[model samples]
Target: MSFIAIDRVSIQPNRRPLNDQKVAELMQSIKANGLLNPITLDQNFNLVAGLHRLTACKLLGLEQIEYRIIAYQDVDHARLAEIDENLIRNELEALERAELWLERDQILERIGLRAQSGENQYTKKGGESISPPPKTTVQLAQEAGYNKRTYQLGKQIAKNIDPEVKEVIKKTPIAKSHSTLLKIARAGSKEREQAEQAEQKAQEAKHQQKQEEMETQAKLAAEARTKLKEKQLIALQSSTAQKQAKQSIRSARTQVEKKINTTPILPGAELGDEWILGRHLIYCGDTAEDKFIGLLPSNAALAIATLSFEWNHDYLIDEAHIVAVLAREGHIQDFCARHRMPFRFEWVLGELYVGIYSQDPILKPEKPVGIEGVEGIVAYLISLYTKHDNFILTPSLGHAEVLIACERMGRICFAGDKATENVDRAIARWQKWTGQEAKKEKHCYT
Candidate 1:
């Protein structure tokens, strides 16, 4: 033991309970009878134990304190010594004691301080070293002045308690009681369960709301369809041939003749609803009649005509079917007059269907046949309309080829077929071009 400057003795990092009321009591005792035990320090003069004594000396305004310097193999050994000294000499809070015990246990294990079992070490030669068993929880608990069960419980509380609650426990003795901490832990679990239930109920409510909205929209749509069907029937019965349409066609023809006579070398094709003259106007029409028209075969033309109106109107053509075919040949006036069907136009990306009318037999153009001619027709008609401002509808299986052709030319084509094979092939072709899979569509016929 030797005297060391009071300022030279630094507190250990793991020291607990600084400036407790016990320090004043110690100071009083030292003033009366003087310090009986010297403070312990490591070679570096760091305080290892007797923190209260050191504090008392400082309070008494002592320039130096009596201390013993101990040599330690490592920091862990030093810490273990400090913890053991406090555990033996002073009463500590349950949490403080638990923390110290855990710290000491870890240090002892880390530094390989093991105890020999039974007489195993005695049987060894005098100079031989024997391995010892590790310290058990019971031993560590006992050293900390707690029974094994209380120590284990305290260990868990120290490990898992919230930081804010731990601070409260350290400051408030009542909060440090084991019962209080157990109650808080249980309450935390219940709170978490309530929060989860609330979130699940919110999700379920949102799903129910979405389902109701869809049902209401579906009902409104069904009512609208019914009203439109009733109106279409009334319109078809009162429809008659338009004398004005024949006059318009004749007037258009006269204009074409006049242009031909004036300019022997016409600069461009004359565009009509059915015919494209020079390289001029692209004529695309939709005559949803059964008559064979245009360059296609009668069967193919009729299929395409029926498909045009059917697909464009979303198979709402059942109403149109009930209305008689009000077109005929020779009476171009009456044929044109009958073109009073209210047509709704919307721009979409798809095929273009052209309409034609005739009295006797419709004249078939001597042009390319099948899909090739259809492609040519689409290309020509495309020149007549702005790309984004036009779309076509075809319901024939053969129209799939037309749709594909239009798509190839960078045109938006909407086409459907009663045949599943045609629909599948059309979807496949579109997917190939767009690199996007087409969703299955509901069809009127299928």
Candidate 2:
């Protein structure tokens, strides 16, 4: 072991984020008995392992730290070593493990340590080396203590899920679940493929550092990322698996919360009554009923409603700045004839017909957002019509997408339904997401 100045070690910028708890524990241990195992670094003084120990020493105000320097062929080789260290020593969360697995595969391929499909040690596939034999998925899976199928699925979960979604999920209970992640990754196949193609095109341009092509390449990359985001957004909203996965995550989080907080959280609100959840409000009663209507905030930003035979929410045009109704063209026309509000515009989103009505003529969207499902449509409507802290009114509690979207988007939702079961499910989902108990209002209209 050679002692080196703490400042001499350089760390990769995009390395796995540090776990504060781990660092703290290391600090306590090192403070008592000193660092027993030295960190590993490349010949160039780049960190390979013992990041937590190194960080703890730094936190303890140590100037020099013990390290072991090893030679490697290149950065990829060093990176492979670092990956091996993490995989062997650390108990990584499912998402973290999945990402490391994918990175390892890529690094192995880069260094000719990975075998391509349909090639064996005895066969020459592309004049590639097979002296020590190449590592396949089966081998890597074995190394990671997982079966081939489980490992491949883990890699797919890492590679396929939207990067943004992964970040949001990283700190949640869902990050620990491989099955839920697989379900989300499997949603919206067609859109996901398109997005992957776009991302691949953008990746191909990364190595082309030509000054002339730089500007053009940058634009292409941006466009590609935008398309990928769009596809993810669409899939996230419209896919059944996405909702189910989130529900599962919510359930898991709630259970975890239960263990920590001893005071049992009981329901405070019920059907034909209203209660506040975080900043939003929900009523377990008919939306058109005067009791529910009387509690409404006058300055709602947008109102979203589905097509119904008992449609009488046209007055929403007056209460909200924009009223959007989802129905077919003929149904919309029939409703337009009966409702007094001016039909401002109409747009087709995926398989749904959306009608826009306002007290005044509304400006058309510069670019219309297409939708393939309720989740997508609700997200789009929330984005297009509402701002932070704006009130969004929804008549139906169908899947709680509007409430979920509003909760995530910083909007206050005023939603109600005649079915108490639907209202109860919505409330439960919200409670799980926010980890706060819903209280029933004292006064109930019996």
Candidate 3:
């Protein structure tokens, strides 16, 4: 033992951190009874034991500290000596003690000191026993004043937990409690399950909404078909070629007459408000009510499949419907310009983008009539893929385009928008152009 300058000794890298209470107690003891035990240092003057005593000396501003030097074969020897000294004292927190044992085990393994079979049996070499029995991890834990299970739990928490979480735990006495870390892990799993359930419910709600829209569209298409059948029956009753020719001539003459007779019927000029188109109770001008247009699930499905297959892209009928409408009605840009409304249309070499501004008056741009090929594709795909007579249609595309596609494909179309103003205008104009008069009935709205 010799007196050495405090500045000459350095604490070991793996030394247990100084406990403030222990250091203060040691300071009080030294003040009363003087230095009782000298600190231990390695050959290079690094601390091997008595860390708290050295800290106490430093606080007392003592320049020279009593230390005894010991030669060590390697750093591992000196590290194990320091860890063993602290662990035997039973003064370290549970986590700190577990860390010491873990480090001791690693050092022993690196030095090839595992307790192999027959390791306790002395082996004579050059008339001397070469090695003592190596200590096992369980034996070390026991020696460190901890049960096997408790030591293992503490070690697991220190090894696996997030460093930030461990830092927070360090501030509390329960920092080394294995139960605390286990509870946190369980909570994380529960939160994940809750998030998944919420996402599934949201998806189900969206699907139900789409299903309702398809049903509405199907009903509308059924009504349209009924009206079309009625018109055919009327034509069949007058089936003679001569009668047909006369009917065509009369229709043409009537359209020309209406156009030439333009007395400019003002919007408010109540044109004797009793118009009925098939099952529809038609309202003219601003008094028209919104129409619920939708397709039957079966028809909606066919329309969606046709559009998706043709476009070579996956889209719900509503989304595809809009794309189809734009593609068929090539004059959308011109219509937007004439209306002086903002309509976003973007065409990138292979992609077409279109979005309508909701604030603007809806435009009923005309779409071309013939699509025999696309119609066949819808029928073929529907029959091939559907499992039942009726199939659900996803309204991922524009309803207008989907309806038109349904019509051309000889499939029933029951699709309509929530608002009827745009659709009604288009229908009225089409009816007038074809000279088809709606059935009239005397009625008045209050």
> What is the lDDT of every predicted structure here?
0.47, 0.75, 0.47
Model 1, which residues run further than 4 Å from truth? 112-131, 185-446
Taking the tens digit of each residue's C-alpha lDDT, what string does model 3 give over 1-446?
58999999987565666679888999999999878999999999999999889999999989999989889989988888887888767776655655666677778877767554455523422234356556665676677677877766666645544344445455454444445443332323333344445445545655777665555555554454444333322222212222233333344345453342433222221333433432223333222122112112313333232112122222333322222222234444543343332332322111222232222233321111121233322332333222232332322223233333232233333332223443455234434443344444444222
Q: Which candidate is the best by TM-score?
A: 2
RMSD in order of candidates: 33.9, 9.4, 30.4
Error of 3 at 222 (Å): 59
User: On a 0 to 1 TM-score scale, where does candidate 2 land against the true structure?
Assistant: 0.59
How would you encode candidate 1's per-residue C-alpha lDDT over 193-253 as one tens digit per residue? 4444545554565577866655555555445444333332222111111112223334433
Higher-lDDT candidate of 2 and 3? 2
Which candidate's lDDT is highest?
Answer: 2
Residue 37's lDDT within candidate 1 is: 93
Q: Please, what is the TM-score per model? A: 0.38, 0.59, 0.38
